[model samples]
Target chain A: MEAYNYTDIQCPPPESSEIELCRILYSEDYLTNMGYMRGIMSKNEYSERALALTEKIINVCAAHYTVWEYRYNIIKDGSNHNKIIKDELIWSENIILENPKNYQVWHYRQLLIIELVSKSSDDYNVEKEFELIDKSLIEDSKNYHSWTYRTWLTKHFKLYNDKNLSFINSLLKSDIRNNSAWNFRFFLLVNNPENYIEQDRKSIINGLVLQKELKFTENAIELAPQNQSSWNYLIGIYEKFNLDINNLKGLSLKYSNFEDDKISELEMQPIISSVHALELLARIYSSSKTTVDKAIRAYDLLATKYDPIRVNYWKYLSSSLNTT
Target chain B: MVSLPCSLKVAKDNTAKIYDRNGKYHGKKQYNEGTIDDGELKFHLKKHLNYFRMLLNFLPNAFQSNDPIKMSVIYFNLIGLDLCKGVEEYNNKLFKTKKERSIIIDFIYKHLVESGEGFRGSVNLKLPLVDRSNEMNESLKIVGNYDPANLSQTYFALCILLTLRDESMSQRIDRFQILSYLKRCQLPNGSFKPLLDIYGKPFGENDLRYCLIACSIRKILQIDKIYEIEELKKVDINIENLYEYVLSCTNYEGGFGGEPFDEPQAGLTFCGIAILKLINKLDSKETNSRINYHKLVKWLCQRQIWYNKYNKQELDEGDNGIYDNGGFNGRTNKASDTCYAFWCSASLKLLKLEKLINVKGVELYLLNETQDEILGGFMKNRKSDYCDPLHSCLAVAALKLLDSEYVRELKDIDESLVISKDALNFMEQLKW
Candidate 1:
């Protein structure tokens, strides 16, 4: 389907000067294959070469629609080389207003922000990044990348600091099975430093439990027993609740070897493979911080039964033995 | 439906019947050395060679022609050629054919709209260089100007440009200019307008499918950086919603509809499946593991009901798999056609489950029902001989994907060109 051409309505005859300009500039595509070469070069080396070409590319396409794009790339590529990241972004912002639909411009802007966060000598302003993410969301409310960037802000800037429960709730309400949102929520739940604190343990676990069904998180282990992430989360929940040791061991074995006759089935299997779950379970059980000997004994039995390739089980055994 | 018991004996018997007359034991068939008549194995071998031959000969004149029709023909033709090999890699012959190949490459560059940022199908004959020049910029603004029928044109164009080792064209691309065109076409609901700046405001049924194509193209081109990753991240193409929308498109008997929340049609099924594959690539993670890719595979397998003898007449009537009409829900829905088989089957391959299909049956259907032995093209299905370039190319691609040996010869894309699924996983693991 050709775009509905309203050019008939708005396009006036090109002035002779305009036509001449088009002729002079039209065939003059930038000869720089620098981007591809830069793709092959080391970062430090490319930065110097990229700066030189950026000037040429910008000069050639400055008034052309694609110049803003080339210029943006030079800035982004050189972002770490200098402190002028904001200046490059402002140039991009001016161009994006003309082409809001330009995914390249939007992508460049995203890279700039991420660069800013990582390159900041002082801790980056998480709040400002969050605002940008929110603004991106308003542009296209369902963008997974924006949600992903937001998740970055929450982790690094401490923007979602201590409000992990509220954050999880908001994500769940938006789209229950947003896989990225679900994964992000899980990260917050398990890594909540407050979860390790004496007072916040029970509350954090409860918060994690509430968000479980949002992404069908509880069912993931049943559906794909090999999914490491799901198993990891489930084990987190088990340790959080101080579930019975023998029962948990039996549960782990039951879900270990998922059916994998087909490719899709095999792809699904990785979701439940008990690697992360086992490690978390062992850490919870061996530590005097969370539970008693029951959890440790459970880990010991599991290690013995699964015969995993990892040392988490042996470490747990020693820790439990010493504690007892 | 006749129960043709699927056994190796029957296969042997069928192969013998095909080669009974050429009975020179241990003697080679004079046509192509070492292609002897040993019965079943020899016949299958020759059949594959013929398939390859047909595909190679069917190469559209467009690659070498300056004519628009010829150029458009090559647009679909290269896909047919690649489909013959069953993988993404080029053979030594592609590199060896210097002069003719360079002509095609030159044609692409020469016709590229200088004022506009994209390539058009061909050079106009009647129009002067001046008028052609006048129209180039206007034409370029609507990069999505190509139809959903020609969705694969851009794919082929990118492939051709990439194969030519022309980094300058890609580098010269105002990635934003074309992307801007792509963005306005996207509906607020995350679907894409089939055409740029069309419908005033109404969303087309194929918008999501187009969006998927656009994103996949960006991925293939190795310019994901050009897209606003954060912008896309914030958009909520949640798997469940997409899955539900796909389900809603299903008809009572289980065909995919052309658009979201419509009756299931075969072409739309391809579109739906493609969208799902795209979504899976973009957003798969722990919490939404319930989407169940296995069930989708099962559903696709069940959709091949027409292979039954009872539906043989429908095949004869040219109702292959893709349907355009809305039938069961008090409306006539389109049936699955040749091109859709490619789309649907390719979607399955992306999920790595193409083996579940009955390769022989589909091959036979495509050969007997759709292949235009007279013209170097295929119809939508059997009984109809009118060829659409898009469907013709896709049928070849679908058939090639089913041939395991041929697929083995095809190359996987360069790692640098594609983001690893593991990297996607690592990114997903992060808090933001």
Candidate 2:
């Protein structure tokens, strides 16, 4: 009954792992994954074998979080660097830190941060890294690595301030509807209640409302239809501006009913992106009827386009087309 | 008015009739009353089979240089023959071309080994197997060591065995081993992954084309034991996800996209309907087993804009190959392709609604483009002057299925294999 049995399966662990990795690398036949990595080193013409070794380690260590942090260090320490490179390094660190059980690695990371802060002085943005680590800890409070890293970084880097605000702003900017980002913002704002006058909080909150990513508030609603935060934010903003809020409340009520219906059906659908949420909004906007034309236009804008015939978009369009 | 030596004369006439007698397409467009129109349809029909014949006739000569294009055509032609006529036709042909057949068989044998990891099709490409490694070259055309059409190509490779009537070859394929690879590619919801992911995890539901390709493989190979039908029942009614996926590819107009709902493509429409039909069968209700034939008929009809009483093309703008209308997605008002006419025509016929479609108009459209004035095999688009095996065979299948009288003229030849009787039965079994 088991799908996997040792004798029946020919997929050798390393061979399979390398084959998988090679598929992600350069897809060539002669390049047995180990040989492929060797080829990558030679092809890229790295000055040293250690640099090549670092790349190999990163490629093979896809499943290991600790190795991701180690790989980040190697890339950051190397001379050739850019914004994307720095971003990727931070992403690699975040991925490793996603699993908070690796306390020893987190502890090691803290020691490295202190050494780097003392060595680089003003150059390193140590405070931002601490904030990211703290955010990860908040997501999973039980994660000992996150808590330990947070305490260590806070002591070494001092309180989060304007120096780290840009990083915080970018996360929300990239994905405004992200609950994690919103949660982190609340913590940072409330953590230092005396940072400014009442006017500062209003301005920061207003800036967030006007931010381009506000359009994705619908996306947040789509992900967690029960999430009152986005609705509250919109209502809060509307009330402050003296705009009508009744329609928004009605939409929220409708979504709650829809969520109940979805749960009753017991379909476990994952929420992938903000645009996916917009799909549901397009539905609500259409009053439970098909939004054929608008749906088509929306999908046209999506990079990974949807299928017209399979979706009810075209069925409705066809009906409308027939009537026309 | 009947021609002499029907089979020989018909074959020759079929090839000749496909070309423009007055050569209007070749700048000699003056032919008076009662004459057929001159166009690329003739040339394309002839070219399709001719290109195929070139590989089969000179297969050894072509294989010595190991030309990928020639080999590709050869492989496709063989697979087309099997699909249209089944393994029986292939086995009969194999006996006549035994010596040359051995060479082709040997080439296939080399790749069908466990060591080769389930028959990687065509080793002559320069690209890698996965996509991410070439991230830096995102703008450049993605290349793979294996053809992107590997699943179809492998199915064709398996068809080669069935054609050879090699019972032993089927056993040697380690069907379960290959099925395991194919199963690994399936998504949790019963759709198939297009290929292995960058990290080697199989990514399912790549496209509608691949979906049909995977299904066709299962049908031809009879790979039922690999998956439990009960497990698939969980997703039997879960049409929304697949529908939504395909819907994502639709444009302003009602035309379907390439795969899982790609852009409005005639071939993909056929693919979409076929996949839906397959999914519908799994529901196990006689009433619900039938697909959304009415909607499909509407979609198929939407793509048809008649150019003349005797000619019809797809709704696409220009030549995007078989799915082309006038130019590649240029304007919907342009002429549709003969292939689309056949595909939509056949689809309507399968749904038992051929009467609802413009059968005579399509028949004339295909008839005017047939190889011999009397035999049928239409070109893809009006611009294509030659007919290849794939289109020719599909046109033949479409025509024979639509016109039973034409099929009966073959005298003792069974064309049941042409339209996939087994697939039809599979469809019927799922009828609600």
Candidate 3:
């Protein structure tokens, strides 16, 4: 509530279009705060007033990285780092809710958490952070920042456990087609630090973990045969382990019914099959010498019927197979 | 193998009702037969040129909130005009005098950081143009601390320079200082932060978007050639670590995410692939071994929507609408968007696999559904009422990349840079 002097540094002239636009879009308080903050920043005045001004500016323009960076510098230089970081954590929760899509808000939160953890390890509450991220994700389940922050949080705190798995499962349970959750699931399985150890690789590929993931993906595929996420996850698992594509031939055949030997007219419409499954089948067939004809047939069917949207891709695949 | 319940069903009707962004019925149109009326298309082009001109001159009150990224908006407007082959018209009509062009150029230069490293998003934190000797004082160190240049803004600045055919851009830009700034922005984990903080520490989410932009800045500045000049090698970013960072962000689904362990998105995937391509590491054995090339292509191809109204579940989920049959979506189970058409198509184009997708279908989607008939720019989707710079610029770039007969008026665009081929040629021909 104290008026800060801004005589030291020059603000944009009143005639500037930026000032005019700011007048139209923002409040007088926002403009005054920004002008004062510019002076404070130029003078290297990392005071409580400067910090407060940054918060005001950030509230109006959450995407401004300059304001966020200045605020971080203020916090780092402040006497009570832990207290200010905790306050920032709480303050940014509201900012995130107001602008969940803003990358700066999430990045600022990450900075606050890092500072909090470094200053007072006991004060770094992982659950609170998770809750905030969950709320943000609830607003937009596929929010890039929220998901990225969540991943960073989990990895940073070494919280890759059953709880994380269950959270991802709950997301998938709500919407099986949530590719974000599916990608997170893959991350937890393959990219976890614990899984990166030399011995864990074998366990991941040959152990019950792979079996469990396969069954989960299979069930998802069965529920929605056309879901590309499930199909992609399934293919990803096999490809990651360097497993044979033929292993998926049976599951793929269940969804894609096509006869390779039967000669058909170019205009004939095939039975409506899962385009994903057909694509998978084509990959499986194309990989083997004996089934090249089958791969061409599947591509032909996809080009003409099931997935005509990517007909050129299919034809390209078929021709490549023929050349080989 | 037992047959599973087939959830995939094609629409029985060959045609569906067309609607504008406001949901006004525009009569029935056959699926996959989105043709543009030449007269209407030409009118739309005129409107687009007018819109670009307006954006470049002065943004309307509606875009007042976008003050922070005014540089990007200018770049979009310039690129949009170039794509429409309206730069000459723009010059002749709006900015006839050399002084006008110089004024615009000076405005951009005003946003450059005092350190001469990079450009700021805006002049909001404009510092006094102090002399270099005076700036070396301890008290003036805050100049370097505050108003740090952003990677994205720097990229946009260079692109704007190229679009404007600023031949002296190389001289104006401090390539070594920018390269040093880029080096500072890179985290030990290999990802580049979008911006730096007061103490020159890299902050912000590690994203492929920033990575791609960093690569672009490096390419535009010709930083790679600095290695041959021994004096400049110290300023170069650690390309090995950057490459590792990119590879680490790849999802099992064969698409790249914005960050590591994030969901694969078309835009980020484009960023990832484009980074590899820019660095000349895309076709390397290490990259080939790591990336699932076929799967990436499949994922990119599958972005094109083949709408089937009979699929009730898909309809309920808003996966694809009748109006979006030929459009591309960013992710799986997402509705088609105008920008993703460029992201997906350009990613494929970078891989020399552009012909794999139905190019005609993309043209149809852009022309008939997202292209605003009455207004100039392209909308995000059929449901959006107004068009913004991002979607409009990308939509035009996508059309240019496709080189479709429907939009032959559009000039060719460099897929990686997303600028007119002429602009790219100008950049390539610049002698530093």
Report RMSD for candidate 2.
Answer: 19.5
Compute the interface RMSD for each candidate structure: 19.9, 20.1, 5.1
What pairs collide in candidate 3? none
Where is model 3 chain A poorest over a 10-residue stretch in terms of lDDT?
Answer: A14-23
Write candidate 2's Cα lDDT for A1-324 as tens digits: 122211321222222211110012223322233343333322322233434444443443332222233344445555634442544546447645654554323543554555455554347766667656746645543233443354335434545454445555665454443333443343344322344345555665576523433445556555444332354344334443455443453555344332232332122231222222333343333443354455344433221222221133334433443354
Error of 1 at A120 (Å): 60
TM-score of each model's chain B: 0.58, 0.62, 0.88
* Count of clashes, each model: 57, 60, 0
lDDT of 1 by residue, B272-311 (tens): 5565555444135641363444334434543442211212
Q: Write the per-residue lDDT of candidate 3 for residues B1-432, one digit (tens) a residue.
A: 111111224344433334443557654443332232322322278888877776666665665456567678878878988888988676565677877767666767777887898998776656443334544345534435567888988999899888878867888888888988999999987889987776567867778888999999998887765568876766688888989999988877778888777888999999999999999998999899888898799789988887542233455454356666678989888878999999998999999998887776777678777787776888898778688888889988887787766568788899887888888899888888
Residue A122 lDDT in model 3?
A: 68
Worst 10 residues of 2 chain A by lDDT: A15-24
Candidate 2: Cα lDDT at B415: 29
Give each model a TM-score. Answer: 0.40, 0.44, 0.89
Candidate 2's C-alpha runs over 4 A off are A1-324, B1-51, B59-72, B79-103, B113-117, B123-149, B188-191, B203-205, B225-255, B259-262, B280-292, B308-334, B355-360, B367-379, B385-387, B404-432
Candidate 2, residues B147-185, lDDT tens digits: the string is 222454556565555544544555466555555556556
